[model samples]
Target: MKGLLFCVGLIMNCLFSTVSFAQTQNVSQQDALANTQKQLQINRYKYSTKAPKAIDGNSDFNSMDITSHGGDLAKLLGDNIYKVDSLVVRGTVDDVDFHTLWDASFNGKLSVINMENAEVKNGIIPEDAFWHSEQLNIEDGYITLIHLRRIILPNGIKRIEDAAFSYVVNLEDVNIPSELQYIGPSAFEQCENLKTDPLVFPEGFEKLDEAVFANCTNLTGKVVLPSTIKEIGEAAFWRAKISSINFPEGLEKIGDGAFYGCRLEEVHIPNSCKDLGIFAFKLNKELKEMHLPDGIERIPNNFADCCINLSHVNIPSSVKSIGKEAFQSCWCLNDVELPLGLESIDKDAFQSCYAFGQLVFPATLNFLGEECCTYLTGVKRIYSMASEPPACEVSTLNIGDTPFGGYDSPSTPNDIPVYVPVGAAEKYRKAWGWDYFTNFIETDDFPTAIHNININKPNAQNKVYDLNGSKVANPQKGQIYIINGKKRIFIN
Candidate 1:
């Protein structure tokens, strides 16, 4: 009887131990499931903004979309990538994928792609059913939105292949089906030659790589530059002819000469510009006016060159240096307010300007380089910014319509117009023996040139071609030859 009872107790203990173990495992599993459910709920709430719409499981669509954030959709994609991956991705038509071939169908803007592997369909992959010889590469990364004028991505796309639209010139129009996000560099380097009309990007384009439209010369018309754009490559719009441009506020670095010779009218220099390259607007004569903001440090050479009709400008107090020959030969330039912070006025910067007068130099100027106002006889009264010209000759010879009618004063033509400061007209007349031109104006207006003295022999060598080949004036250094633009060079 005692042996039987001991055996029963052992059995009961064993049964109880088995039940406890089972209960513990069940509770642990329930807790794990609850945590997982909580995580999934949080993830769903987090990605509520980016979730895709519901669709039938067996729907036949060209492509599928994946969420950027973590959620049920992301989890499902991660779980069944190999199964639904083929349908989401497009296989290259040919085994040897030519990037240009892909880009020629899209207008660059595609870069991320999950192309099919080297799996066989019949004799080849189903996506590789190419009647043409073109191919999509397996190892290559190519993302093309619409290659040239050949391809059109009507259905929404999923991912991009890198460098896919590289150098596809024929691309004319682009209406990226809201699914695209990437664009690579040199994608449309020279595409303006392909289409005669201007190209417009879809509203969704937010990114751009370097040198995208480096030399699209014929790409005319204004474009609202993407606000998201940060950096632009040098000479990106090297020789384009967009009539007017107001760089959309977000652009930071304007790559060296990006719009070097572009036909821009008026540009309001944004504070975003930290460095403006030299000769950036060299020959853009149509750029009539500009307003520079607070941040510019140096005004590089030819920055306002050939802006023939540019009449008014207000140099900001922020400017420290006007680079060498920065505003050379802008003939029609009329008014300029030089800044107080300016330390130097580079050589011949305001040279040959007919209307630029009444300059008030700041007190801080110590280094006014030689020939800063060359051929600018219009300026007789330079209000000294503390330092006067060391030995500047304010004599009659240098205070007239012609600063270069000879240093000894003109023996002929006593009718030359002499303009001087309020009390300085007599100073010039007495110094240079120009008592004949004593009828000068001090405050305003010069003696009108009603009588036109057309010089008979300008070149002297080409006297026969008087009204045809050259100017009729004598070859004087400061005498504007044929109103300047018409070059009267004596071919030596």
Candidate 2:
């Protein structure tokens, strides 16, 4: 009887121990689930006034939104501000709120911001509102804000201060309010993904600040600036992918590198434009033609440098000086007429222009910089209207550094002829850098018209007219023709 009683007690004790172990595990799992649910919870705050009330639930939240009148978002969200991924601010916000939002984007999960219904005080998005701090990762000397993807600006905002959205690489969309009056320097610069097709500015904006859209590679298509735009600041559209742009009639100035490295095919500067900056249109590979207005005095430096496909240009009669490297490496430039009032051609202005078969220098020209006309392998003849040769640079280190130096190779014969005024051949032979030429011919044609024309050989019955409007079937050599009301010469 004693052994039976001991076995029953042992069995009861073992059963009790198993039940206690199971109960402990179930409680532990329930506690773990509750903690996970708390961690995943998201809290939203809506304030009707300037002062915010204490958050009711757990303080930790993954995201938050302030729907109404929040005084300062940073203080309202408190310690949980950095954990937010999406932010929505409506009604009224201040510069401090924008700064806090920028900080969250820089350090935390804040990515999307919606402020379409909100209004910022003073009608401005303050300077450096979204400019990432210098502590983040930088590429090519620019701080790229990779977190923020989208933002909606308030409707009544009038101005966006300097560097407001500069280097926001991942930004995809933003609304430009109609009431906007000014966009400060470096605004929207380097925003590679922001695609504003046919970029149109509001009517009230008068100026495009410096580097406003610089390095925006995806911004393409035609751009029509508003008539109120008076000036385009320096490097405003540098390295953009724009195919064409139209300048307003009242535009006064175009800053340096404003359209450099673009894909412009043609440009027509208006008569009101008085100033053009250096490298304004340089490295434009697709540019084929350009027409300078009558009032521009100087062609800025590197104006059309490396434009290999450029074939024609119209230099106005009022131009006084051609800047350095203005037309360098333009290999296909075959037709150009230098106006009578052109005075100076700067250094390397026409270097490597291989398609110029003939050149006529104006009478007023007095200065020619080093290598101004170097490497012109296709030049057949040159006419100088000036009685005195233009002053050419003489290099001590390289003999082939003058205006017309290296025009003929050592292996190829130096057969190109230079035509001068009736008594100017001896003077050219004695002039600096002009003495290198072996052949000089004097002529009375102070302003001879040399036209490049391709004529199809006519059949025997075709009518051809001479210079005096006389008909001739077979025009002889050195005879000038007036075919189609235009002067033509046949050299057989």
Candidate 3:
């Protein structure tokens, strides 16, 4: 009887212990759940209380200030996601959060995004992070657009990948981070309303990718580039409204159409620049003057084409060839001294330059392209320093279609005299393109007065006369003349 009673007591004790253990486990789980709920409520309150009130007291329009630790923001915001017009994101965020924000912007609900206090994952804004496409109509097709008006990038971001913020038409204010090192191609292209004045890049920034700021028509004022930049990619600042820009010293190359169609008034290329692509500064109607540094070997095609107001340019001696249409259609270009070492002038290099004075070709010149100097109606004389006439293409069989055809009226015979080296007039008369000219004057003391000049004495009483003995009304620089009956050069 005693043994049976002991067994029953032991069984009862085991059952009671099992029940107690189950109750403790349930209580722990319940406590954890309650704490989680409490924390969520606190976070919700934090967001709601700090969020800015809607403008003009419109309750329908709302701005939210949210702190995201990471992951999809849509899930964190819950149903309040649709009401955001402006957002201030803080704490940690990732690409998933950016995708949600992009959707909100595309719906025309979000306008301003400020993430200055946020920390992006990997310190990089990934490629097309906020890019989205929408189909508007059958005829219009798919297009990318966004309604973001202002964006303050996080301070820790180091790189922004290609097309990250492209086609953000309403974006006007952007606070670029100081830690930014690289911005990929077309990152901000077509952001027409972006008015960031005095656009300044960070100190360590290395390059500007292709079409980075292209078509930003309202981006005016001075542009400050960093010294560490090496290359400016193609069409980087095309069609911008910038008035002035300083090219840093370490810059090595300027890609094609880099500054094309801009409103730059003057440009001073640095000596460190060695390569220039076609149309580098073309179509700038407001450009009045430019200075090309010494290391550039060739002036790329259409370098300054159609610059109507360009009156002065100093071509360095390092230039070997002037590319096709390099300075074509510059109506106001009147003062240019071709360097002595220049070897080639490509097709239509200086065509339609109406205001050009006398042209002096260097002895190193070997080839002249078709119509290279056509339509220079104002030029009175051309001094060919080469004893051997440079090779030129005869455009047509008729002499009237020569490079110097438009210098004289079509009704009258071609009378523009070409001055050649001593005993070289006969050589020029037999040359293919030079034979088109009817008159050639030979001179023994041709270019000596141009190179050797004594300007040390005061020219208060000295009278200058041209080689033709015509009294000069205005004596221009780099011209050979008989000053006080002595052959001398005058340059000011």
Alpha-carbon TM-score of each model against the true structure: 0.49, 0.75, 0.79
Q: Which candidate gets the maximum lDDT versus the true structure?
A: 3
Question: What CA root-mean-square deviation does each model show from the true structure?
Answer: 24.4, 22.3, 21.4
lDDT of 3: 0.73
**Residue-wise C-alpha lDDT for candidate 2, range 1-492, written one tens digit per residue:** 111112222433421122221122234323422332222111111111111112444434365667545457787767766667678887788888888887777766577898888988889988868763442322232233446778888879999887688767677777777788898876877676777667777787788876677767777777778888889876688777788888888889887677878888888888888878767788789988887877787887778888888987878878889977889899898746787888999877888898876788998898888777877877777778889999998543356656777444421114577888889999999987787688999987643344666453444554567533468788776545655555566654
lDDT agreement with native, every candidate: 0.44, 0.70, 0.73
- Full candidate order by lDDT, most accurate first: 3, 2, 1
- Tens digit of lDDT per residue, candidate 1, span 411-461? 223444444446655554554333434354454322211133343343445
Give the per-residue lDDT of model 3 (tens digit) for 25-129.
234323422332221111111100123334345548677898898885888666556567889999888888888887777753678898999999988887666
Off by over 4 Å in 2: 1-66, 75-88, 134-144, 396-400, 407-414, 446-492
Worst 10 residues of 3 by lDDT: 40-49
Prediction 1 global C-alpha lDDT: 0.44
